[model samples]
Target: MVTGGKSLKKFHDVVAPADAAPIRTSYFIVIFGSAHLLLSQLPNFNSITVVSLAAAVMSLSYSTIAWVASLEHRRHGGSSHVVDYSMTASTSAGRTFNFLSALGDVAFAYAGHNVVLEIQATIPSTPGKPSKKPMWLGVMVAYLVVAVCYLPVAFVGYYVFGNAVDDNILITLEKPRWLIAAANMFVVVHVIGSYQIYAMPVFDMLETFLVKKLRFHPGWPLRLIARSLYVVFTMIVGIAIPFFGGLLGFFGGFAFAPTTYFLPCIMWLIIMKPKKFGFSWCTNWICIIIGVLLSLLAPIGGLRSIIINAKTYKFFS
Candidate 1:
């Protein structure tokens, strides 16, 4: 809302296709797959594994359809609506109401996620023209509409079921057997589709690292090992441990912290003290500050995550 969607979308090109290569597709798959595996193990959602998987698969199918449509529009040498946005969420810990109130955490994530999107959007489009506006506006509007849609669903769900509306909104409102069946169907389809989408970045990264950086021959042991290790890591995290808090916090703190807390502070510091250090002096200060905050919050966040879980569900031993 602070910035126009047009202004916002021009930021995606920040991550160059070449530079993004090392990220490895296997890592993404493992992470999402692991998340599925982890969530599946949870008492509430464990039974819904098949449904969740189906949801992920649906996401993939939707993405394919969307991508093909995009290609078609591209060939037409005109334009179409493509809304891109990013989201940030608490690690398995959720928001620690003590250190950062849920309000603060949510605001931080929203802002940080936006910055990531900005960086990603920095890539140039075609030769001369930048990406367009109506498309961006449509995205912004749709986000609002979706939010609007959610409000009614939230009210109806809570009013109808009280505390039953717990971790997942659907779980509360799903009173009918047929609805449960349909929901399960949707979930499995969604998981496959979404997993494939997240896997792309990891895939591109691993491929680039192997082919270009390490110069490993096709199907070489190194490449094979990398893929195998990545897959194993995914399963370990996805199934064995399934810790969301650490993963969420690590990325949120490392990536989002710089963009949100540090960047603005650095920008302010630069204007305030440009000649003091002569090189990203403000940014350096921000980095140090963030380091200190994260250091302090790391243990705090961890403890808070545990306490919060204890308070809510006796899932812990």
Candidate 2:
């Protein structure tokens, strides 16, 4: 939602610069949340197939535009901005913290792992045709797509903009105004689907707790109230503290690194019991160590960044 707001702002800046008064991001967040109130009502994961598909396409489209336009900018010498590849931070401590936070950002990119099981659950499985087969294929294809979408944007964008780039590459590109505007809209659409994908699991957990533990009667009323409340709570929080990069770094390392990086490897080791000091054992151990370190260190940097930003930020402004 925050990203969508930024995109909308970028679009507004392009289309109506004369009348583009500075709007608070919170308003855009509310608009984004309002759309989700309707989308969150979708019954289950399978029901959102079309939305998910469109989001995936939008992601690819915007990502492609980001890098391609970056290359064009560099090639055309669009700006006199000197591309400096040096460290963005001035001090050692700042550099270290930024480095750690960057690791969290990288970890955040793999956050789709959190919903893998839920998505697989939606797939049909039979004795003769297990779901894992198709799931594995899908996972491989998804990873390939991620690699394609992410790598060029990361490498080429940095190459072009260097350390001066914004947290969002789209924000840094200026010329080709219409294209940038379109890319921002694509980002908005993509994040809408991404938000729903991440929220579906939380919704399920909330509904389960209410139905099983609290003994709420299972019906549309329960779902409506529970899901609406969940959306509103998140919306309120977003409005309150919409620190995009900081939040990504914090949650990425705090929540995602364990599940995405190490937990699966640990589970494999425990279930398969690979021979001690063997390749699989050693690899998994290495992964665990790295993931553990990421989980421990990244949040500190993220928190520090949030503090630094919060010092200047106005509440809901």
Candidate 3:
């Protein structure tokens, strides 16, 4: 929610500053609520799959343009907007907090590991050999392609805009107005698709829980109302705290460290039953320790970023 809101905010800030000021909580809730309600009308997951594919293509197009543009900018000797790339904390504690928040943003950016299993389930396998080959190959290819797409864009965008780069890279490209507009449209399409993909699982879980608790199997009307309410809830929360990097940082550090890193280490240790103080045990323990430390520290950074940014934003805004 935070990330999406931030992306929207950045787009408005960069592309249409004159009409940006009224981008407050009410506006976000109305627009996002309408979008979610419309998307929720889809009958099933298969529809979402189609949307996700379209999103992938659109995202790829814009990302490629941004990546190439950054390289071109650097080649032309355009000065970078970022002055420092060191790991050390900048002068202020708030800057250090924002830095950690940025780390969370990076974590969110690479967070597809959890979805691989979901994706694997979609691939068909033959009976005889129980061919997991396709699944493995698909996952490998996807990750490889993502890495190829992301690395150059990140490196070049940072090289070109440095610290000045907005959270959404496409916003940095102001030239070639038609292309930029097209890229922004792609961004909107991708965001809509990606939003459905991410939110559907959450919506399903909530609906299931509600059905159980309320002791009623909701018909389509009730289901629609329930999901629409959830969407509104998300929009309200996003409106309240619209700090994009901070939310990414907090969720990444606080949630992903456990799900992505810490839990796996513990699971391996338990399942393998490695000897205490042995190499396997030591490595697992080390990972757990690091994960715990990161989980503790990352949220603090996220919180600070939120605090700093919140001062400038109206609660309704």
Among the numbered candidates, top lDDT falls to: 2
Clashes of 1: 50
Q: Which candidate ranks first by TM-score, i.e. highest?
A: 2
Which RMSD values do the candidates have, in order? 17.2, 1.4, 3.8
Q: In angstroms, how far off is 271's CA in candidate 2? A: 2.5
Better model by lDDT, 2 or 3? 2
lDDT of 3: 0.71
For each candidate in the order shown, give its overall lDDT on alpha carbons.
0.41, 0.88, 0.71
Q: How accurate is candidate 2 locally (lDDT)?
A: 0.88
lDDT of residue 137 for candidate 1: 62
Off by over 4 Å in 1: 1-124, 132-135, 138-142, 145-164, 172-174, 211-213, 218-232, 242-303, 306-317
Candidate 2 local lDDT, residue 39 = 95
How many clashing residue pairs appear in each of the predictions shown?
A: 50, 0, 1
Q: Model 1: per-residue lDDT, tens digit, 58-146?
A: 43443333333334433554233342222233453343433443223332333322322332354355545545454466446545643
lDDT of 3 by residue, 248-301 (tens): 788778876676667878988889899999999999899888778777788889
Query: What would the C-alpha RMSD of candidate 2 be, to one decimal place?
Result: 1.4
> Where does the lowest 10-residue lDDT sum fall in candidate 2?
11-20
